[model samples]
Target: QSNIIKAEFAEIGERYNDKRRSEIIPISGDLSIEDIIADEEMVVTITHNGYIKRLPTSTWKTQRRGGRGMKGAHTKDDDFIEHLFIASTHDKMLFFTDRGKCYWMKVHEIPPGLRTSQGRAIVNLIGCEAGEKVKAFVSVKEFNETDYIVMATRKGVIKRTALSMYSRPRKGGIYAIEIREDDELIQAKVSHGDQDIILATYRGKSIRFNENDVRSTGRKTMGVRGIRLGTKDDYVIGMLIVKREGSVMVVTNKGYGKRSDLSAYRTQKRGGKGVITIKTTDKVGNLVGIMEAIDDDDLMLITDRGIMIRQAVEKIRTIGRNTQGVRLAKLDDKTYITSATRVLKDEEENEEEEAAETEEE
Candidate 1:
């Protein structure tokens, strides 16, 4: 009865063309007493015209051998697998073309062990946009040599020196500024205020204050008086000195002895005839009408008080002339006296000269 049942089942399989139970499967040229199952791993070949063709296990090898299975599979003419068979577990898809172009797509989630055609169909149904162009290779370090030919469209191609800082404008804002160094952004901010000045030290410490706090005593700019505190006290306005002869002398406005008490005793000395010589302390020019004395180049006042006094160079000035009332000679580089004339005595030498003439022709 079992043999009869087997014969009846075989006849039924032959009539139905069931290769699973048939003795010989003409497609793969193999006997299949058991069921002839399709290969679990099925590859979908996509043509250039976007046609998908599914080949079974028996016909897959033959189609591959005939160079007609996959669009870009096993070909040397730059025709590579354009479509990737991504499983549902893959969150990222990496695709490479025969022409060396690469693409990377990131998906939120993928379905499980999905068929290639079904995956492609779902991808088309989702209508996702193509990813940005990415480099086929990634470099761990920066390329330093200039000899390398750099592609212009490559990512992270910069013209700045390594680790150099830069100030750039921020996006979506007009008043925003960004500082970046070595392609990394930094933190900084700037603002405006009143007429305040900031003083920064070499050590990076700074002090800021308004103009009033730094104003000068003279109501001038703080800079006009300089940063020193005692500059005002050092400024000399006038000077006064008393001579030993009970005469008072004062100097002001770069003039010397302008207000003198010796006007009544000008031509007289205490116990002898005397003359007063007023001269500028500076040797180069006259100071306050006083011709510069040869010895006192800066400025000196000689008085019958039997005392010689020198005033400050800035305060010394020429005042007037000698007793003869002649203007004193202005002291300069070119003025010099060669000689002084003196009268020769002739009465005592007349008899001696006559005797000498009688002795000589």
Candidate 2:
């Protein structure tokens, strides 16, 4: 039996003695990943109920953002797209939770499906701790110190940290910030550290301050206050970094909104009581959202009732600081504006002109 085993081994060894070689043979695992996985462009849609899905990018090529996006998701009536972003299948998506921890996943890990299909729950794709929910996320292709991440809390705390710090995260998730028990991270933005930071509160108050006011800090520290809340329930509802000059539009729960010039909001010391950015009353409800807008920028406002309305900023009627300008959306009872964002900084006029040209043709 031993002699038979040794003879078998010798036969195997002789077969590979550089005598068996083929010029056309290929190396193992050398196949192109693009071929194995289609590298086509994808459209990623995230709904308010923590659902995320991806469709082919061509699905939205001709459809402008405010022009009634092709039913991105058929979620519960209560759900809507709170955060929407674009990334290639090879990009990395970083999910920052309310608990101040972040989870990272490749864009392709998100399953691709029909535009109307309800997406997989975020919690099922990424591991989130109990009671933790995704508040904001950034799709990053490269992490560099040249870029900075500006984070704002619901309690008005603001922090800026280097983008390079998040280049490598642990599999179990790492702390993005040290948040208080009562405060949750509400906004996260990528900036170059020189843009102006705007914080709008729920009670129609807003403050614009230099981004340098808050010193860049490490990941484990609590941020400095950006806006001082007069009441316990008064928290920040909107935050954004602007590089260009524009008005800050404030939208209320009753769909009342107005655009006030940036010149109207004088830069003040951080943590001070903000000036009255708009009027709020028992009739008009508290402010629900805010955005930096130009005269020609097209803004999209979505309500909790699943209604999306788009209008040019010029049509919003720029007004003084202390007035509720006009009704942006006529809403039913109990329905309020959930989120507002600029669909395009400038392009509505161009799109309209092109449409008119086509009509003439």
Candidate 3:
């Protein structure tokens, strides 16, 4: 009886058509594993301690220039949102770290939450070293060789690499720029190679040079000096790359900020003693950041105390290089503006007719 059962099983196994059946597959592989959250634009925020989240474009009602914005984040006294950007959920965000490595992710990958709620840790989403901190990140639809990412360091070093070099990123990330032990990567801006670069120093000094001055270099190499620091206390704080339009904005920690005409900061050779970009005074405090923006752009100011204020850049008076800037944000004894970024004009205008209808519903 045992021999007969074994023979029957063997005959059944041999008769099965395993080869042809295994080759059959579905007609289409187009089913999406990720949700479609790209219908609306989002405002993403990254705190100093690496907490990040995204909110809808309609999070804060638009405000006029100089009108202190609504409190946008509830952060610890020591932590504040250091970076904020306007991007579509479908766009890819290339997170660049201080160690010269980068991690690529989509805006949708960042879980959506309220502005007051601290979101997930960015380091977890994009694997990074223990001590590595994000220095700069940019959003792009697709990497193209026509555009370049110009990076600057705390020691006044600058490097430019083609965007195509970062098209393919890894789980562990790859080299974006080389840095010495004593220096640190500070700022990054995307622009055409023909644009101009404005490097602002801590002590209210800045230099404008043609982007062509710094030739494109490899991803693993260090760059040449973009400015000559006037004092040991002064380090490069802001690096703005812009074409012929827009004004250069200088903001101080004490809440003083002003917009200066780009033409006022005449183009100079790289690595020179930059002219006075802002007059630092006891009341005005130290220069904290600089931005390339126009009157139409909306300014988002983040205080070290975690307070965020959104105002129009047009409200801030455009002054000269030697003048102390006007009050861009009102500050208290222990609070002051730390970092600031701009939202484009079109992105801020969310088709009022549609937004009003949504809110009414």
Please tell me which predicted candidate would have the highest TM-score against the true structure: 2
Candidate 2, residues 1-361: lDDT per residue as tens digits? 9999999999988886775465676678766554467666677878767888887877765855445334556778656655556788877788988888878887888988787788889887898888888888888877877888889999999998988898887887888899999889987888887778889999888888988898999888898989999888799998978777878788888888888887888888789988998889977788988888787677778787678877777777888988876888888888888877776533455656667888999
Model 2: ten consecutive residues of lowest lDDT? 63-72
TM-score for all models, in order of appearance: 0.15, 0.77, 0.71
Name the better of 1 and 2 by TM-score. Answer: 2
Ranking by TM-score: 2, 3, 1
Model 2, C-alpha of 109: deviation from truth (Å):
1.7
Give the backbone clash total of model 3: 0
Q: Give lDDT for model 3.
A: 0.82
Estimate, for each residue in 73-109, the C-alpha lDDT of model 3 and write its tens digit: 7877656666677888777888788777778888888
Model 1 residue 284 lDDT score: 22
- Minimal lDDT window, size 10, model 3: 344-353
Per-candidate Cα lDDT values, in order, are 0.25, 0.81, 0.82
Model 3 per-residue lDDT at 234: 82
Candidate 3 vs. true structure, TM-score: 0.71
Q: lDDT per residue, candidate 1, 1-361, as tens digits? A: 9999999999988899844664763576666422343224333343222222233333334432113232223422222223333222212232222122222332322222222332232224223235311222111112232111111111111111111111121221111111122221111111121222222111111122332332222101011211111222221111111112322222211222332233322322111212222232343222222111221123333322222233333232323423122222232244432111111122234445456787897
